[model samples]
Target: MNKSMNVFVIIALVMLSGCFPSNDLEKKQVHLTGITMGTVAYNIKYIEQPIDGGTPIPSDVVVHQNVERILKQLNQDMSNWIPDSELSKFNSHDSLSPVKISEGLRRVIAESIRLGHLSEGKLDVTIGPLINLWGFGPEARPEKAPTQEEIAQAQARTGIDNLMLEGNMLTKRIPNLYVDLSTIAKGYAVDLVAEYLDSISAHNYLVEIGGELRAKGFKHTGELWSVAIEKPVSTERAVHQIIIPKDNAIATSGDYRKYFEENGQRYSHIIDPDTGKPINHKLVSVTVIHPSSMTADGLSTAMMLMGPEKAYAFAEEHKIAAYLISKSENGFIEQFTVEFMPYLK
Candidate 1:
């Protein structure tokens, strides 16, 4: 796992759960892969389940269009890069009054708030100011670390408490509040697509966006969906582990590949909203499995920010299945909650 998986999920070469089907469904399998969500690409493999009694699956073109439609709407609603996106417009709004928002945006923001509290504000969606200050956002990178006063000013502009939601409306106590769903939006989008496949009677499927992924049913061969966990190394791509999701969602967050090294110190793109600075911890990556991709997404990010010891404790306390990799004097160390032992190969 790397920052690409956390930031946008740009790992396209590794097919974590892209499996083949049995002889019966071999020719019926429909696989779709393409770029979306600004930079990352999505890979989906599914077989349309029988409809009514024995009705055949719709043409591949129809399924393609349907999935594309869903993703396009998500980008329109949550993309911070799009000037006219729902999230961007919300950020541009200077009024304190509640603004009417789409149901989808409201749901995503609502989940983000819950996670913000769960991680003690470490998994903030309204952290655009601080992200920009550290040269990770739309702003250009600064030559040196931000001054203490500058960090304080950015901190003042952020906080999960600053945002409020009522019904289908959203409100920002401070007008300049900006929201970026980079941490979890891809997973949310993956979930939405999975829901669509379910609606169309897809009996078996694997949905992956960037590196956030979810799988369901079997491969038409009686095997559960298997995915690869990446080794936390920047020089090359290698599998750290292979595990079956057992009809669940999985998300991994790390920064081995996307960070700056200066004066013998490394700076991760993942910001600690509380500190208003990049995380400097030894923990390198976090992998979480959950029923909901959105939850797994947020949990992975939050755990990464917590470092190793605290993350392991939190995962155990919450009974979450988590795998953590951290830097060591010699090389790296591995630890996972007991719940994760079941998924190990």
Candidate 2:
């Protein structure tokens, strides 16, 4: 599957975004950058001063290797591109039987099911079949759009209810039920790296995988790190907002960049499970902030399924820090929940 099509958010990091004065940052900061999770680029940064005060710190080489190791293990367990990945194996399993999976796999699947259920089927990870039918997954773009019969057949294989988890054992109630965790996998990886850094007493750091990100503590400038949220536009990248993390992780979902058009009708890469087609609503973007990048990732995608009005009410009712943008006759309309006020620049 093309993992890049899973999300449309573009978050520009402050430290690297030229937000801070170049001559100001003189403190020792260890910045690590690499590509992982099948084309996702990430960079982790932390002040060496924090390690200086800790009991002992691993060498930079060890830290890099371990971080990449964690990412590699995660990919082996959950990535859809890896043919032998645990997730791919399970998807190929055409039996209604229980299969033992790794604890890490169980963790991500459990959260995905929970959020899928909570959102009332708005974010089903089991929508892989429909995704492929729409030519968004590993399959090539169909010569033409799928017929209703084809869509119904694929939709039958979806639904979070078809999946069940008993401890570390995950089961598929239907023989053809396929699961895909592309939506939330990067966020889980982000949290995993952050936890590992925390275990090493690296509190003052920022971790990002793809667009899902998390941060803690102040930067070398003795101030909290800020991140830029780009406006939802296909022409050019523009900063829509710059906000502090509030000691939380951030995830954004949008549909401007990934879509297909046919005969004047536009189809987004973000599928609506209810209809088994691309979302056609006016809500173009959704960004959420929470302590857990995984949760924020799930919520952002879930809110994208809900149009602007419903998403706004949902965020307010849940007291979630959400920023939503919708298309209008004049221009894009922006709305943020009260909880999101503190995050504004």
Candidate 3:
């Protein structure tokens, strides 16, 4: 096993001392490889079922390489911007013919659109035009803030409602609407990595991508993996941590991560679909934990756009656990739902 995996295994054993049936353990790290939609990494750790000691290094190294390859394919194959990508071709043709798509692409898009509707169109995949108009991502940077007219035009062409799913084929209701899957692609990739780990009988593992995390079973120490929530603006460290003990996924969305500075002002990439403008909420970050990574992933963005108060209320109404860190008039304020408070370890 690699040094890092060794350390995690030690931690897991210590945590499991009281919970697990036996002290003898065989820990192995598997580094999976493969790239499908974008960039992804799976840090998987598994305990030998019969306590049979085994090598952890070579197996882990191979797994890592496999995961990388999968992510690469996903990025190229599903990108909507690429005219030859599966997604773009599906959108280009107006016909409702059943088109076969990569299972990964189909699953992610279906989940994204489902979450968009569940959030009342708060988390939209068709915000690409608006995202580009605002100079985010690969879209050209606007020299200055776009006029209200320009913003409205982009907004008119963007919406989750514009997506039409017929049989195995996907078509856009709006002629020029383009779909951007960035919001949920990372989480979907994490989900795929988790599936692969399970297929290999790797039970204790945690997968993370760009900050989104999904942990199953226990950490190397035998205790639940403790993931820290980074303070907004402080990428080097986490302000709080959540200990994972069960099968759950967590995703945090904030304006601090992706932004551009111009004329002494910082503009975030997160845009409010309803307003057709960037979100100016005082929230620093929002962490959402739920059963599905897709839901946890998209809800975090929606919560950021909804602001603290509304976000909190939404979480409460849906019985979802959420942790919101906001910029108060004085300093920072942290709020959590009743269900989420317990995870604030």
Per-prediction TM-score to the true structure, in the order listed: 0.90, 0.92, 0.84
lDDT of 3: 0.70
Minimum summed lDDT over a 10-residue window in model 2 is located at: 1-10
Instruction: At residue 307, give the lDDT of candidate 3.
Output: 87
| Candidate order, lDDT descending | 2, 1, 3
1-345 per-residue lDDT for model 3 (tens digits): 001100011121112222443464334434333334434334444443323333332356566666666666667666765678777676566554456777777787788888888788888888888898988856579898888999999898888988866545676676777788888877877777777666666666777766677777755445565666666764444344344425788889988878877788777899889988888878878888886777788889888888888888888888888888888666667777888866655
Candidate 3 TM-score over all chains jointly = 0.84
lDDT of 2 at 74: 98
lDDT agreement of model 1 with the native: 0.83
Native-to-model Cα distance after best TM-score fit, residue 283 in candidate 1, in Å: 0.9
Cand. 1 TM to true fold: 0.90
Per-residue error (Å), model 1, residue 104: 0.9
Please report how far candidate 3 places residue 15 from its true position, in Å.
9.1
Best-fitting candidate, measured by lDDT?
Answer: 2
Residues 1-345 of candidate 2 have per-residue lDDT tens digits of 000122235555674332322345555678999999767899898766544456555766888999999999999999878899999999998988799999999999999999988888898999999889988887798877889999999999888999999999899999889888878988999999999888887777888888788998767776677888778888767667778875689999999877787878877888889999888888999999999999999999989988888888888888999988887776767888888887777
User: Candidate 1: misplaced stretches above 4 Å?
Assistant: 1-27, 49-55, 220-222
Candidate 2 Cα errors over 4 Å, as ranges? 1-11, 15-26
- Candidate 3: minimum summed lDDT over ten consecutive residues — where? 1-10
lDDT for 187 (candidate 2): 92
